[model samples]
Target: MTTLLIRDGVIDDADQIAGVHVRSWQAAYRGLIDQEVLDGLSIPDRAEGWRRNLSDPLPTIIGILVAERDGEIVGWTSFGSGREEEGAGDGEVYGIYADPAEWSTGVGRALLDAAEQRILDAGHTRAYLWVLDGNERADAFYARQGWVADGASKVEERPGMSLREHRRVKHLAGS
Candidate 1:
């Protein structure tokens, strides 16, 4: 197994991040989301969206962690403070996708750890994120990381539709 290093994303990572996002979405959401939504997935659109997102300013601060192996970017994680309406005094992880090839190899965990530290550094003591209702793998991963379901559910917008999801949170103590 190659050592996976997590680091801040550079502008050059736009395409890589987009590829991971599209591939992971297809793999992770297939059979769980509507077929139309799945069929309409566009890598170019997602790439442009990510490019704009990383360039734009908003309520949440966006950061990316790229997991590299043998000098090639394999996976990445993006996170930031929760939206103002989330009413949580903690950061929230929005997009997390790793190459399937790197699954269970600690890349995702390393990214989560780095994001957690960033949140803590921002003086936040907890973090939360939304996971699709039927994404057992992701939910399980969050559970293993000590995040608990908050008993809240909401509709998450997808392509031309909305999907159900659960809010999960993790409490962090002082370092």
Candidate 2:
């Protein structure tokens, strides 16, 4: 694989990020989430949301990062202060996605490492992210990166279904 570059995501990257987001969800969440829901994902709608978020992020958003391979975006992540009441002092990885075709090619790992470093640089001792409950692949990936399922779980309401997600936490080494 060529050198993978991780950089701050720009407004222009919204469409590519949304493409990865939609494809990753369709591939990664297959069976775990309703097929109809995954199939219903709209890249245009997601791109618009990304455009809005990138241009004017919420106060809590620290940054967004994208992974590029040979000048094409293959993955992206967003992180900031934790949103849950129980995670007040912790950093949170809001979302991370790699193009389905890029899976297992180190894209996800690279993006995650960057996100962790940014969180640590922001003075966070701990960080967490949520993974859909039945995503064994993601569970294993996070486990390999030293994140553990901390027994925290929640059911999020989607369009016409509820999805269960479990929280995974990691403590930065230098903390």
Predicted model with the maximum lDDT = 2
lDDT of each: 0.81, 0.94
Runs off by more than 4 Å, candidate 1? 84-86
- State in Å the error of residue 156, model 2: 1.4
Q: Residue-wise lDDT of candidate 1 within 142-170, one digit each (tens)?
A: 89988899998998775577889989988
Q: Which candidate has the top score in TM-score? A: 2
146 in model 2: Cα distance from truth in Å? 0.2
Q: For every model shown, what is its TM-score relative to the native structure?
A: 0.92, 0.97
Clashing pairs in 2: none
- The lDDT, on a scale of 0 to 1, for candidate 2 is 0.94
